[model samples]
Target chain A: MSKSAILRSSIAKKYWMALTGLFLCTFLIGHLIGNLQLIFIHGEEGRRAFNEYAYFMQHNIFIKVLSYVTYISILFHAIDGLMLAVQNKKARPQKYAYNNAGANSSTASRQMALLGSIVLIFIVTHMVNFWAKMHFEHIPLHTYEVTLPQQTNPEMVYYTHNHSLIPIQVDKVVVVRDETNLYLENTDLKLGEGYKDLHSVVMAFFGQSKNGFVTNSLALWATILYVISMAVMAFHLWHGFASAFQSLGLRHKRYTPIIAVTGKLFAIVVPFLFAIIPVLIFIGYVK
Target chain B: MASKTININLKIWRQKNANSKGSMETYKLDNVSTDSSFLEMLDQLNEQLVNERKEPIAFDHDCREGICGSCSLFINGEAHGPDRAVTTCQLHMRKFKDGETIYVEPWRAKAFPVIKDLVVDRSSFDRIQQAGGFVSVNTSGNTIDANAIPIGKAAADKAFEAATCIGCGACVASCVNASAMLFVSAKVSQLALLPQGKVEAQQRVLNMVKQMDEEGFGNCTNTGACAVECPKEISLENIARMNREYLKAMVSAE
Candidate 1:
């Protein structure tokens, strides 16, 4: 083993970022698929089924090993990114006086570390709320169904618009309801069930506030943080995923474009889907 | 082209030796031709300096044609001057305006220690290349027929493009990572693409990349700056190829 880091080149650092990032992307897909199960069936049956799904994932030996790999991948990705960034900083040693070079790249891509750190914070909070609860937190596995049936209502209010032919509704509201109406029988109240009751557990956090107004306010703030973090994540993955593949040296001209498009699709579509889950739950659209 | 003359200020770096303190010494030049190549302008300044009994400003040069890549200068804020896809020797004085101040400096890298004023010891690149940038082939020259081998057009073009890397230190100078990934990848890909080189590709890439790391050059951050400043426009794709090769080597070694 090369004991000294003096010989480490930027090329090696790129490989480090690429390999670890690609691994994380794979992990994200698996995570998204697992989370999507929450949207499948509903009521007590849905919760039980979801819990069973979560239980199998958490307990399976193969998955356990994969989970360890995933953990290492995250740590490696973060550390390697820092290393590459530091090396790059040293490489240029000087700064340009005037930089008007923005053409194709985005601010988000240029500021990857900032975006990643923000997402990291969100990940920690997310794990504490959901992942930790599903794993370490010993919560009751009694499945609770949260529901928000589609609802739209128009309330008459005067618009302050200076006369226009188009009539704009001044106010619109969608009502949602949460009810713990369903239960599972003969199923062991286990860790996975804790995940299915995810909606109530999250609401329970907001519900902890002594004042109803404070609870609603806290829930709104939580939703905002979730949305902002997910958006940042979307941007980070947008540049990172395809860039990682290129860095890892998987550049068949044809497949390169394909991978680029697929990476973008994943970054945009998956995060949008995740964003929806929070919106739906916060608005009481899903119970 | 008309032989128009222009007077300009130059902030050229001067250092007697590596241990000596370096500073930018300014010089004024007049009657410079519009069509005069940048190196010719340097020659005029050196002639004037000799007449004035001052040591002629030291710089590096070889074939004035851009191919040899012996000439390198950080003109103003740009590497190899403002002209795109060309080295400093090939950059014409026409690119500059009359009375403009030009800042020139040697390629700065810890790996590329300055040998004198404008020339650095680039043998580090040679060392990197020597660290297995070639296929382990004995020069029998009788092993393979050109017609017998086949490669896809895209792969062949990419390979040729990569091979065009003139081993200039421009990529190192321009990269914020001081990454020679572009250079290393070019060498790795050139061999990895052909059947003749396939036999030793694994060991070749592994050794080259290892040596590259050992050279104290920074990592490739994929900023695309190296590609931008490369006289040949060598793509970041070369880095990608090296990555694939390294990964393959790792798995095969297993």
Candidate 2:
């Protein structure tokens, strides 16, 4: 087949959809695992762990490449889906006098485009909320004080400052006050670092009464939107997970049932975990 | 068995040809027997029209038993009428209430142009079949035994199920997107599963899918109306199987 036929054909479009969709699913898993640290880890330690993870993800060479790939996958999936929907609409120029499609197919399968569009909107809003801030805006840094045990020699102290040791000096620990760096900051004092503090941002965005009335209201509204978006994601995944497999020509009578069941569980559990984060934070359970 | 008869009102689409504009023309018919098939009732109406010296309605049908798959009609917003798992020829009048209004229209799709009232040009399906719906087998004197190749019982059953598709085009009519994935997949799956047809599997799938796309059919989103409305009770699993075959073929193809 010619290159044009391979790429422009309906079957080709389906292959693209399936491949990109599976890529997005993998991204979802990685993202969910990182985000769960916000709820699973407790207090300052949790905040520190999450911030370090975030910093590493943003700065890591391999992760950066993966992130770029993720961005392309999302764009391709959305554009391909839009084109498919448009062509499909044109295929049936004349509308049926009556249609009862729900009788034949599942509601999720029929409404995939709608659910996908909703998810796209959610992704844009979510990126603007956190990702844009992290990448573009100059956000405030967190600072806190920490104390250490007495030291032995001047060379050791000099070595501590020069080497930028995390514990300062092993024998005689040095205390750093109002430290902004996570590595230099004392873990015992539960000190906040000066590295964007996304944990704090997330907490303020979902927690109540820390920011004024307007901020509180905004946080509540944002939490509701996040939860609703998670529900929409659930709907999209319900059909999409199995559909991606089918599109890739991975169907089998013996194993398809297992794949389908696993897909359903993944769809429910992942989104449910994501949705509960904001709800828990808002209700003061995660704080 | 003797069955009672009743009256019915029908609003049927009327089109002279492909280029002509069509509209619904209502007619009231009396004494429609409950035992009569939906097509039989239409025949009675045509007889009445002929007796009145008017142009009769043109509809398509061959092998009224539903195996020929020539019968194509949209009755009361359903392909082959409201009854499940049956064609228009098999839909008995007993399914409808007396004096109920019945709406009849042709299969609506860009690929299927109306040739006349309720009769569509379904040659698109034929063209797709021509693309690669066959196997290249030798017809020499030295013939292989019919059951020489051993196939698993499960695989054989699935191939049989996929082979039951009659190319009736109800799948297209019932689909909101007018997708023929069900029909194409049925053909693809039947051949892909059997050993005799597996030799040219890659080329066959690629060719058939290309032809289907060229025919201007909609992409399948797995909405599943095709399988539901199919007279043969074809399974959506066939479509999944075809997708697998297409992807495998594309990967291994030159």
Candidate 3:
């Protein structure tokens, strides 16, 4: 109970995990709301509206800073989870071959680290595709001046590989040309000036009407990952939420059941709602 | 109904002693009754082994009534048996079909080393309890009103449920993490709920958890597997309650 010791023990690890996981949960809600715009608005109007939201989020100093914090939260949550799991594993070096008691917990809950690792792989792939192009890559603002490449349409090539590349186009329409510079018209909006920055790229990526199938498919995968990850998150939160309260010393018997149920309700409802946005967009049921 | 009899096979673990090699040895038992409890059936098998001039299967048991909880065995894949709520001693042969092969093993935990065959040294749980669990009050000739504590029925019921844990290592045996939190929590919780033990509540939680850690029991991941397999259905809430108490104790000591 010494001040120095209190800062060091398994209890400290629990606090770190709780704080980081809760922070990520906040980020999920915000991300869902932004993604939900894909359903509410369609075509140019939808593109513009979504663009505006992305621009505001990117340009806003608070959100810009929060994005960095979000990155840190992800790292800390993973590390703390690993530390706790490893410590727990080392605490008991023995294992039973037949465990019939596993019926009570979901596979995701039992294999949290495994699920998190898969989600982590997805996140990395996702960031490299979209986030890299939007933030890291020096995508040209003006596409008209750039000569058309000698291969298949760059937009199609990009889409088939990674859905993060939003075809650049002006007014949601652009001219297509063959290698001979002949007039061959296609509506798959090519890359344009809006993709020069992070926010514009996000807006253009989600807003464009052409390549509807590709865009929707990517959204579906994202939604699936979001849903699966959130399901994992929910299971994590299932044990975590109630355990956090106890770790923080909330033990009033009357409040304990209330907190436990509240924890469960929050765990289920939040992820379930967040998972719906991508499905709505992908199925063309929304925007 | 009168007890029926049947023949069964038991793939039991045999060790000359803890110092020697252990392996699975199959033994055939004849005329085991469907109405006989699992322990009684074991008794029948042991009687046969003894009459045949073989060392009977080494297992632990005391009060055959299932209250002592010393009868620890892994029946088939289950910690106790297929029944949702019952101990091994309480498990009846009726749950199994005749001529079935039953795999009986001791409680598998690093902390609960095998004393012999199915009997394990679960004294680590006792050490965790001895560290600082029981109410400090001495048993005197004085009788205090039970109502003096003013505990609500719900709290009293929960306390009783927690107290139902008979120092069995089933929670440790069944847990994937081999966590003893339920057992430790039960002891810490039962005493903390009553005023008679309030004076030493802070020390009790701290000492018990430390002893629990020292005994090599895994931390509670709150998977709730223990509660499901618990012969007593000891709630995971008790573990949560213990965490709260331990946290409070840690802070107050600071």
Candidate 4:
């Protein structure tokens, strides 16, 4: 066997899948931890904290690099999976008249391609609903209530990128349209900064216009889809987490059992927590 | 022990040839002895068919004790019927319930094409073995004693276990992707564990895996179905070992 290539194409392809898959799993943990703040923290403090976190995620250089890595990993994982799925389908050109795949393998394992495609769809729509809005739209900044000079009613607020609301003179404040920084009137002196209220966007996206209960038809449907997407994610992770180690040739009897148990728990806990966020928001359980 | 007989219906696949489309043909088998093997039950059906001047169902079987991997039948959606760690020849009729309908089909994979009813072209396995399943040995009369090379008991036992693979395509048959990783990995592990085979281990793994891909076998999804359905109860550890060997070979290659 005097082959020039050391690694076969299929095995090498599997290496890429395993690497990208494990990277995505790490991304999931980080994402889940950040989102859990939606429930663990409450009220205006929670909103500000979340908004600040989103800002840091967007602006920090290291996080920016990691985000790009995440994007690349997601794309590679999805595309490579699709290719492998097609090849696998072709491997059995003639379909079995009666196949009971669930007899020996897991339903999740057998239906990985189907589950992955669903999760991909969810990811696309999820990014559109959150990431695109945060990146592209001129989101309104966190508002602070202040009464105008010579006015008793407190309605107006100043927009600043400063995550927390600070005491400011509304009369002396000069605001530029679609700008993040607050300026002293008629001067270039900067007063404070503002942050994109991503927390509000996330809260509104989930069916909580003002409360925990689903307020509108769209919010109800969106909330349901969120929960469903999380379920799909759970199923995908069920087989994928442990399977990655196998694909990577990291299988050890002593560690494998622990890894498998950890995978199963991760499958249940992560998605359940993720689903809980939307359900709570939909029902107005938290701000 | 008293032997019991059970009446069961069979939905066996019937294909004229490789080019022709196959379909499930139903047959009513009466009073089949539960102690008889599944192949024996099929033999009874064939004999009856012969008496009725009907064509006998074509199937592959040898060494009905399950050592020879020639016997292949997808019984009731499983590689070797519902039972685990047994080949089709070793499957007893007692496993089936009375009045139950068993669905029997050929091992389905692009690499293992169905030649007739339950006989598939498993020459793919032979071809894979030919690729790199052996160590390069030259007859120059310079061969050393077999026991000269020391081998650990654990390694020896694991190698022996890996060597037990009967070259059955059951692993391919049961896999959702029809992945041959288990079969190929078993061969890779069997030799790579020995000092004699270690010399060319890198080349062996590379060529074997390459040949497996060229044969149109799907990549492993780590579903564990192959190991679950393997007649020899081959461990998934072999596949993992192969992966380790392959990657090491890949990076260390000159």
The all-Cα superposition gives candidate 1 an RMSD in Å to the true structure of 12.2
**What are the candidates' C-alpha RMSDs?**
12.2, 4.1, 10.0, 5.0
- Name the best candidate (by lDDT): 4
lDDT of 2 by residue, B51-155 (tens): 999999999988999899989999888899888899999999999999999999999999898999999999999998889999887889887885999999998
Q: What TM-score would chain B receive for each of the candidates shown?
A: 0.94, 0.98, 0.93, 0.98
- lDDT per residue (tens digit) for residues A1-287 in model 1: 23232125445566667777888888888887876655555555655666667777888999999999988888777776776666656655534332322322356556677777787778788888778987776555443333323353233323232453333232321111213222222322111123434434644443322212234456767777888888999989888888887877778778989988998998999788877665665775554
What is every candidate's C-alpha DockQ against the true complex, given to 2 decimals? 0.36, 0.63, 0.28, 0.64
TM-score of chain A of 1: 0.72
Tell me the TM-score that candidate 2 gets on chain A alone. 0.85
Best by the DockQ measure = 4
lDDT of each structure? 0.71, 0.84, 0.69, 0.87
Which candidate has the highest TM-score of all? Answer: 4
> TM-scores across all candidates?
0.72, 0.88, 0.76, 0.92
Model 3, A1-287: lDDT tens digits are 65543544444455566677667767877987886676666655665566557657767899999999998888877776776667667655544434565555545446666656665666676678666775656543321334446575554333221557554433333334332232214643333324233333443333322422223335445556656876776776666666566655565769988988987887798767766655655455554
The TM-score measured for candidate 1 stands at 0.72
Docking class for model 1 is acceptable
lDDT of 1 by residue, B75-178 (tens): 77566877779998888888999999888888777777777777777887898889877765456876655657788897788788988988877887776556
Which should have the higher lDDT, number 1 or number 3? 1
Error of 1 at B134 (Å): 4.3
**Model 3 score (lDDT):** 0.69
- Candidate 4 lDDT, B22-115, residue by residue in tens: 8999999999999999999999999989998998999999899989898988998999999988999999999999999999999999999989
